[model samples]
Target chain A: AQRVTQPEKLLSVFKGAPVELKCNYSYSGSPELFWYVQYSRQRLQLLLRHISRESIKGFTADLNKGETSFHLKKPFAQEEDSAMYYCALSGSLGGGSNYKLTFGKGTLLTVNP
Target chain B: GAGVSQTPSNKVTEKGKYVELRCDPISGHTALYWYRQSLGQGPEFLIYFQGTGAADDSGLPNDRFFAVRPEGSVSTLKIQRTERGDSAVYLCASSLGRSYNEQFFGPGTRLTVL
Candidate 1:
């Protein structure tokens, strides 16, 4: 079975400090990893996906197949960056192109000014 | 254009009562998904519909949960004999056509069973 583990349930950092939210996965086949964020009073939105390989809001996550990790990172943290972050994995559904995601518990990040 | 939308933003019902939650996907999206988010946990997949058929229903916990997209655009999830454990935020999402594509999510419907 595919599983995603987020070791840290909560992380706090001051402004201008670097932040890293750890995520580890257990899957045999190639996996598509994604980072989703939910801000206060806002809907859950997609932050970044490994396939895009593009940075969003100065956040980036690299898919590490060897280590089975896709940790989300930012060089500097801002107060506004505080939110709940989730790591999701997508794989083949049945025998078709449709895919379903399995998400980790999530990490609540608090960036203080 | 509007994104995915769910009806009855919040619903509170007594245990043993039945409930129905509705979801209206994006205008042209061909794929719709249902997920349940319990307190302090990530959303768990419930069902997936492509066009008018349920492509996958393996995530559904038991036979008490049933969903239908009769017209291929709107979907409804019906729960029988709701239990306290069934309380959660049910989320709906829709993607263009393929599951790999970006999925737009709705605000979600919060269901509470006492």
Candidate 2:
């Protein structure tokens, strides 16, 4: 079974401080990892995907195959960065059930100003 | 272009009652998905549709939960004999064709059983 683990349920950090949200996944084969964010009064949206290897809104996640981790990081946290972050894992492309994503219990990041 | 949209933003029903939630995907999107999210938890996949056919429904909890996309654009999820545990936010998302594309999510319908 493929599963995504988000250890932190709630994370509080002051504005302008560096932030890191931990995520660990378990899958037998290659996996596709992604981070989805849900801001207050808004629907869930894609924040970043590991395959892209690009930062969005200053947030970046690096997939470590050896460690089976895809931790999301930011140089400096801002008020707008506060949201519920979810770590999702999907099977490799071309697999029968890869399109559906398995999301972890989300981590709520509260940026204090 | 418009994003995904769900009808009946909020629904309140008594236990054992039936309910139906609607979703209208973005124009030209052939893949649609349904998810259920409880308080403080991430969304859970329920079903996926490709064009007018149900490509996958392994995530559905039971037979009481069923969905249909006859016209390939609008879909409806019907829950029979609803239980208290069924209360959650039903989210609908759509992508190009169920590949590796980002899914566009709707506002979600909040279902409450009392």
lDDT of 1 by residue, A36-102 (tens): 9999988889999999999999999999998999999999999999999999998764554536788
Query: CA shift at A88, candidate 2, in angstroms?
Result: 0.7
Compose the digit string of candidate 2's lDDT tens values, residues A9-111.
9999999999999999999977889999999999999999998999999999999999999999999999999999999987974464557889999999999
True contacts kept of each: 0.70, 0.67
lDDT of 2 at B102: 88
Candidate 1 on B9-90: residue-level lDDT in tens? 9999999999999999999999999999999999999999989999989999999999999999999999999999999999
Model 2 over residues B1-114: C-alpha lDDT tens digits?
888999999999999999999999999999999999999888999999999999989999999999999999999999999999999999999999766788889999999999
Candidate 2 CAPRI category = medium
Task: List candidate 2 segments past 4 Å from native.
Answer: A93-97
